[model samples]
Target chain A: MSQPDPLADFFAADAAPAVDRGFRMAVMEQVARRRLRVELALRSLATLLLFVGVALISPVLQRFAQLLGQDLSQVLLVMLAAGLVAYLGHFWLTRKPVLRLPHLRFF
Target chain B: MSTPPTDAALVAAARSGSDAAFARIVDRYQGPIRTFLRRLGPYTSDADDLAQETFLTGWTELRGLREPARLKSWLFSIAWRKAKGEARTMARNRQRDHDWQEIRPDCETPETERAIALHQALAQLPPDQRAAVSLCLGDGWTHADAAGVLDMPLGTVKSHVLRGRTRLVEILGVDS
Candidate 1:
């Protein structure tokens, strides 16, 4: 076997920087705290958007149903049920666990 | 002596809102993550940025990790994704100059010649084979560890290492 090249070893060793233990710990603590804040902020923004969207669309939907000689309350109920079903479907699709398929053998 | 707390314990604590525990996890794995990024061809500055992004993403998604004991591999997986993402972004932005210059940094005469030769040899190999050699030999990761970190099949990892080593020996004119 040939000897290991010193140049290769040197390049590998010098390629990465020296990490400061204390600074890294501090940065991690900062990131952890920031993550919690970001999560909470996203949740709040999503809730706000949901409320605003419903508020802005409810009256418009009701007026359109009434103009078409349809019962506004019944139309609203159907629409609400459809929206719930769609939302549930989307949630199920997104949150579903990744399933590993069975191995296939070919002779 | 009290046994040191395991990675799972530290990860669990972080999930439950312990900043110090999360910091410990970062301290434990940052070196390996940085080395991995460097091997992927990022210079020090970009490598540091990507490393920081990896940890940030890891911390945000830590709660969703099913197996806390596999934290090291999990962290490496995130780093790999981040590095690839950055590479794509750089390419899209027409920032090839920055990347190429970073990877092929200037060195003194003999060192520069060797570095260029090694870089050329590595570039000729397939990306997976290059990663296998850089991570396993350059970064000092075990074959099994590199396999787990790279999310490759163990057998595939072994083949990549063997093929890559043989190619490097031939390219560098190393005697058998």
Candidate 2:
């Protein structure tokens, strides 16, 4: 027969919390969130690098545009305006009122 | 009955980005890890948080674990480090006092008194000694296993366990 161990008995009284479904879900949720963050960060980095590369080559592109009798600056301005309009259109369609202009606020 | 997947298999799947496999690992070890943290002095209150952080660290660094067979001890080591780091900055003494007050009742039972005294005596021990006692005595871990998790020498772990057990018995006035 084994003798009663007081120390072990004391520890036994302080029972461990039951392993529940919630803990595993919580941990997996964290892992998913981490994965999402990493993906977002990488995408953002790629976008930034693309933008920097375009900016760096703008001078050479501008010279080529002049030889072709086209204004690169105007083309770039039109693209930027299109991008802004698309962004605002998205916000408006999504019902994000904060970005709506005064006349567009009602919609 | 079908046997559950082995640690190595689960670890390999988890490293391959399978959430289900990692969740299995979490389910398998959370109880032991939390209990171990609770035994480590003054960490009972935040053992859940420590356990969660340990899992999160394990998830992010899964690929770096050289030996998947050592996953259990690796997780415990991570948990031990998290508790130790938190213990240094948190006002744990105040929290321990508050816990005592919170558990106080109009009628004090012998079990309650013993529980309170046991935690108090545990709090009084040095952190390393307390960790040794908690892992080896409270959790029934082998001395070598405790030593690995604690990053302590085998001799040091044995010594800490012996001295820590002696101190606990002396303080609680209980027979070892």
Best by DockQ: 2
Error of 2 at A13 (Å): 2.0
Model 1 misplacement above 4 A: A1-8, A15-18, A21-26, A29-33, A39-107, B1-3, B90-124, B170-176
**Residue-wise C-alpha lDDT for candidate 2, range B1-176, written one tens digit per residue:** 99999999999998876788999999999888887777664555477877888999999889889999999999999988898897766554667545753565577777656666767778778888988988888888999999999999999999999999999888888887
Model 2, residue pairs in steric clash: none
Candidate 2 TM-score, C-alpha based: 0.75
Q: Model 1: how far is A5 from its true place, Å?
A: 7.4
lDDT of 1 by residue, B49-74 (tens): 78888988888789788999999889
Q: lDDT per residue, candidate 1, A6-81, as tens digits?
A: 4364345345445667548656666856865776777677779989999999999778777877576687789999
Question: Model 2: what is its DockQ?
Answer: 0.23
Residue pairs in collision within model 1: none
- Cα RMSD for predicted model 1: 13.4
TM-score of each predicted structure versus truth: 0.61, 0.75
